[model samples]
Target: MVGVMDDNRLYAIGEVARRTGLSVSAIRFYSDEGVVPPVEVTAGGHRLYDVHAIARLEFVSTLRELDAGLEDIRRLLAGGLTLTELATAHLSRLDDQVRRIRSRQAVLRTIARQHTEAEQVVLLHKLAGMSDEDRDRLMDDFWSEISEGLQVSPDFLGLMRNGPLVLPDEPSAEQLEAWIELADLLRNADFRREVREALRETFSGPGAAMMTSSKMVAAFERGGVIMGRAQEAQRAGTPADSPLGREIADAYTAYLGEIAETPDSPAFREKLAADVLDIERLHLESLEEYKTSTDPYTRYQSLVAIIDGSARQAAEFMPFAWLSAALKASVSP
Candidate 1:
């Protein structure tokens, strides 16, 4: 409590409250907490504040509003911590709080939408609680296992072995779901073995294993141009049997020749067309298995891309879809 005061520089607690717009009790609590002690005390035991003390009260109010614990504030006032350190600590705390809240929201939405089983509900909560470092480490280990001892271009492997997945601070339900799916995929031996075997077969061509990294990159870039044309033709609804389609097919045949170290001839074209159909059949089989839905791997990468704001270039197998059509047309009657 504070009564009338006569000093021009010193103010009663009431005036300090009026000047700072803080409640009388709040200032008292701050004083009692030793965060902002009054400059003087009256004979009647009232607290008195000079301008400097009032300024400190205002600063204390701001810190309290930011959820700074009293001990931290006291240490800050005692010169044990700098303002920059305090702000940085609080900022990191806020980031963690926001992440947790957003994770809870995502978990709730996923559970409600999916009617997730108790077993999975437990797992989802565990995943939501994981720090970014733990999540990244888990992803790193999975990719390491997938690419281990593979006879493929390191550059090619690097593309699929995407770097850290930085889930946005405020993750969406979809992103969480994708993360969970990725975690599950990593745990599934069948998925791991299949992905490895596919990579093995794709890179097992006679000349593919023999090409230097630079040659592999050069071949990949040249193929990119052909796939770009394939995408354009596909987008324009060009008939597969059109001359334009055959031209694109011929270009792809040459690109394959470069990779296979085989000369472009009808025999090679026939072999290429047969090889293309084999891949096309595999894709068709996948579509049948999933009823034309996005494959789990593709869906996971796409969702992760949205979260991290990084582009996940469409998988190589995807562009090859258009090329498969052209190859079929080139070989048909």
Candidate 2:
């Protein structure tokens, strides 16, 4: 309608029909449905399109392929549904569909292994879901049983209990899988007993009380960073035995000394040294069962050597060597 009369570029309904394969009546119905608006009408009152209608028809065809209802398509075209908001909603629905499909695939995979139908069904159920509360309770029970027999101060036990595996109420498939694995781990009596034994030793030692816990944590944090640097310097050929390690050891010992009521007592430092070494030895021996003769680097063995050989030398010499000293300080007037 806005075109120059002499210009022959304007398309009539028949041309649009040929171009888009949509009947004139169908196009008219779409315009009425608000799927697309006409460009204009001619003076003779005939409907005219200026190349835009073909594009609109193609868009409508694609929407129809996607099973979008006509009214929904109309709202989309009318700007009632924003592209971002609409795409996000569809994507969330698609994700759920994908999760269900993957769960079925896992069941099929297990069935391929000649599992019984009941077993397959159980596996699917295990894979499919978990509630947040179930995850929390699983961790709570594990940590509680581990800490129950330990004389570990109340604060340390509380801290361990708080590190629960938090899962969403509507978790993704990956999260569900992790939850199942974690729950299975919690059910293992060997693992539970291992944790209990470890906590018992750590709690029975000199740093069992709240203040000692705080100081040890601070020392570990401070010492760990220094330990990393010291090892790096030694690895760089700085010294056969870098004083960096010794310095950190000294700093850790000095920190314990400052807080220790018996900083100057040689007997206390020597006792603390023996205690630290004994704890490391116990940690190593307990894990020896899992180590292969061929693999010299078990986790516990490596950790003990690293801490014992390096900064832990001073760690062994912590000035606050006696729990009785710490207790007396706590009750002092």
Candidate 3:
């Protein structure tokens, strides 16, 4: 039997466990796996480890705490890999885990705020899983459905095709909610029908598909002049029935006359007033309904689309309720 206190000063498994703060079984397992093997064995079969083995076992404990796999740790202890290389690879894995955890946290925060039912939760999770291209395709599909057969300019069509309400990567709670609301709005059958009907009316109206790029520019320039005059009159507190209001109405009437291919006369002014009121009614019934709906996200989208379309087509002529009122007050007997 070897002497208990040898010249090399080896420790038994119990002493190694006590010194390293590792369990006795863990020390035995590592010793048996040749990870931190004992230097010598006593005649009674006691495993006696060299002092250097304690340092190796302690290192293994640290790597285990860092979530290094047992096989990798075994390989590391077998001198097949460098510590720096293992640390760098483990760091990369940790970074990926962190990203996944953060993504899950963002989703949880979004779901928490929604107070959503089971199906809605599932739907939101599905949306969260979508890539940016997938989300864009979803929005494109909705726009295509509504814009089909509409005689809109290419620029206007592009604007509609890329409407706002894009989902951000790693979106915040509010952005996620906005995406959900926008998706719901797109899925609504009634809203789709309303948009399609509104487009049909717009394409069939007086200033309809006749707006080429040049015509659109001219109309916007003319409309800008009229709007500037109206703004000045408004700032000066001109009454809707004032002669200045009549002048602005006359300018708009001339603009419409150009569009409708009619002479700018009192008769045409009266006819234009009727058409403006009809357009106002249709606007109120369709896009304005979405603008004032409960969903603020969809509401903003609707308002942006309406304003953008009006600006593109220069169809801003007296189509508003207040503008219709002003024109009636100016042109009435």
What candidate 3 gets wrong by more than 4 Å, as runs, is: 1-8, 146-333
**Number of clashing pairs, model 3?**
0
Tell me the tens digit of each residue's lDDT in model 1 across 57-127: 98988998999878878889999999889989988999888777877877787788788888888887887
lDDT of 3 by residue, 136-241 (tens): 7777777788878877776656644545444433444445444555565667777777777766776777766666344675676687687677656665666767
Q: Could you give me the TM-score of model 1 versus the true structure?
A: 0.57
User: Which lDDT value does model 3 have at 89?
Assistant: 88
Q: Please, what are the lDDT tens digits per residue for candidate 2 over residues 135-211? A: 56666777777767666555545544434455443444444443443454466787677657765666676635754
lDDT of each: 0.74, 0.54, 0.67
- Name the Cα RMSD for model 3: 14.0
Q: Predict model 1's lDDT versus the native.
A: 0.74
lDDT score for candidate 2 against the true structure: 0.54
